[model samples]
Target chain A: MNKVWWKILGSVLVIYTAIAGLLLGVPRLPILNESIRNLYFHVPMWFAMIVLFSISVFYSVKSLSSKSEIDDIKAVESVNAGIIFGLLGLVTGAIWAKYTWGQFWSFDPKQNFAAISVLLYFAYLILRNAIDEEQKRAKISAIYNIFAFPMMVVLLFVLPRLKDSLHPGNGGNPGFNSYDLDSRMRMVFYPACLGWILIGYWVYTIRFRIRSIEVKQQAN
Target chain B: MKKILFSLLLTLATVQLFAQDNGVEMADKLRSDGKIYVVVLCIVIILFGLLAYLFSIDKRLKKIEKENFPKN
Candidate 1:
């Protein structure tokens, strides 16, 4: 697709997926019953959060090592987007929990880990704001951002794997793998994930552009 | 001040949550599927897209900067 066409396509896909996710994915799931449909929205938000956070880390590393102002902007914008997606993920997950787990906020290991990840990233933003010097802010935030990224990965992925739990997919609980998620569900779920993620990217790009403009205006 | 406020909010949340059931273990079990790798892959793809967009923005900004501040 041409550039304009690509942008149009992205926007269309986002709208289409959102409608499909709500209308179809949530209602038509068979395996794990209707509750499993939460994956369509909640899972994608988490995925977007991870993606944006990793980009923040990359920019952080680049900014610190090379002292590139552009890198710092990217790092900041990525973190902002990551925070937004993380909050969405948490909220949606909580709603899903209220229905399935019969509670809103649980101290489950994964949930705690998720919360810690959010707090750590939020602190990264605060650290950036606290520093006065541009270079120093970039350098310090970069280091912390890198550190936070891996910590989140371990908390959300590795640590949970090492334990058995009350969650559905953990502790040898029967999950999507063994569960009978049919082809119909997969159609809506995969696209929904992609569409939300693309929408996330659109937001990040817009924010990044705005930051870049601000930097240019400041320079002038 | 914001930090202090956040901490106080967090503390309140923790206390309130403690009064209720802590379903972390169960929630973990429910969400801890092998689909994590799929999540990782999706994350990587999104990152690449964002990175590419950032690079393009930087280039565009540099062009604008040169236009506005031509160092003659």
Candidate 2:
């Protein structure tokens, strides 16, 4: 976790993606046109968010089992990092929607659900702050994190698909995999997802370290 | 009336086919003009700057951790 090699690799891969994503030949589909390239920049935000939230839930479960304050801190920091990525996903999705879907906020099922899931995390953070006792706060919030993770998955992955949505992989619309995401695009897209995920983890670790240090200082 | 409606439908179908045949408009001209590189360079610079800042923060945090927790 402390290794520097992965961090360096993540930076290199992201730089490569930024360059290649713009230069690479993408599928020329009507309506989507050049904006299809946004798949590289926009979609990865949600991927990173999901990965970070998964990490948060893992730590949350560990905290519940062990009753450790550090584990609780880890869970909270991961959620904090995940929320940043989620917001980025929302903003980028909105911008992409504006050109393609004809509006910034279309009240699409996917968009509405994404927003609600983010609000759900916001509630977790608020719930954490509402508690005054240390162990009590950690225990309650960890349990909340456990519930929030699955709800987030259902909100993002399941509910949207059940209803009509302008977003891909939902409603009647075909996902990028069925068409458009050809070999040429995959070269950049996969690396972009991985690079962003690594970067998200890096940010989470940094926040965790800083928070840990602050906790130690308070104790001393 | 049926003939007229059928002809109109055929015309609409031909127009759709023609649109597809023309192909989806991409930024081919921008690529050929060699200006896309400029945008790529600008984004790379911004990314580099952000990563550098993050690394510096990590380095400083490591220094503080070392000073505070010598045993660790």
Candidate 3:
């Protein structure tokens, strides 16, 4: 979509998210209470983070196979956005956990996994900076990016299920699967997720354009 | 697609278990008095507006470039 339309669509989605989140994100029902409402933001942030990181990995692969500068740019932008969302997800989740679990930072599988993912990307950025050759940097970064996805998948998805913890969905801990979400909450929750994902994409696009412009300016 | 379905299933189970718990009702009642939701709403609205504005400005720049430097 063009810029104006993107703004318009994004505005509408944000408005929708706000209204829906306020009405439903704060738990009012008999089962979930208020802490449950954090799902509107926490879960979706992580979802967007994963989606963006996955996109980065895809672009990294493309850049490797074709030696395309465009693919390299895309990989960089996606990873940058992914990191932002990942940090936000981590902070929001910590807050949610504090309220629900009475602790700020637990050594839970999910928490540790997320921290590792963030550190991995931090290394990715460093790798890019340490290299002077454009093609070499792109290739190496792509190789590193590929490794990131499996690490994330294992940390976020696999490890949590393998062991028991107080965190949701672990060790018989309550999670989205074990709990009964009301239909009313679902109405807003789905849209909230879509809105967040779209906004994430929107942010990525803007950053990508800016990066492209900077590259052009440098070349000229 | 399958993952989405699975996530949904997992979500359903979590919600079911939550609904069965007895203390949630009391917590909900107390939460309603806090009005934190309103703050969240306002923050989201502001963020949306800022991003939209930034995107529009970027679009305008591109349009200007296209107008000034047309390829023959």
* Most DockQ-accurate candidate: 2
Off by over 4 Å in 2: B1-34
TM-score of chain A of 3: 0.91
Q: Poorest 10 consecutive residues of model 3 chain B by lDDT?
A: B22-31
Model 1 C-alpha lDDT per residue in residues A1-220, reported as the tens digit of each score:
1134444455555545544544453334433455675676688888888888888888888888789898999988988988999999888888877777777887766677788889998898899889999878888888888888999999887776667744656656656545545676677667766766666666677687677667777887
In candidate 1, residue A143 scores what lDDT? 85
Clashes of each: 11, 0, 18
The lDDT of each candidate is: 0.72, 0.93, 0.77
Q: What is the lDDT of residue A95 in candidate 3?
A: 83
Q: Write down the worst ten-residue block by lDDT for model 2 chain B.
A: B25-34
- Stretches of model 3 off by over 4 angstroms after superposition: A1-7, A25-32, B1-41, B60-72
lDDT by residue (tens digit), candidate 1, B6-34? 99999987885675476343434323444
Of the two candidates 2 and 3, the one with more favorable DockQ, higher being better, is 2
Model 2 DockQ vs. reference: 0.57
lDDT at position A168, candidate 1: 57
Error of 2 at B21 (Å): 34
Top model number, TM-score: 2
Task: Give lDDT for model 3.
Answer: 0.77
Q: What is the interface RMSD of each candidate, in Å?
A: 8.6, 0.5, 3.0
lDDT of 3 by residue, A115-163 (tens): 8989999999999999999989999999998998899888888788777
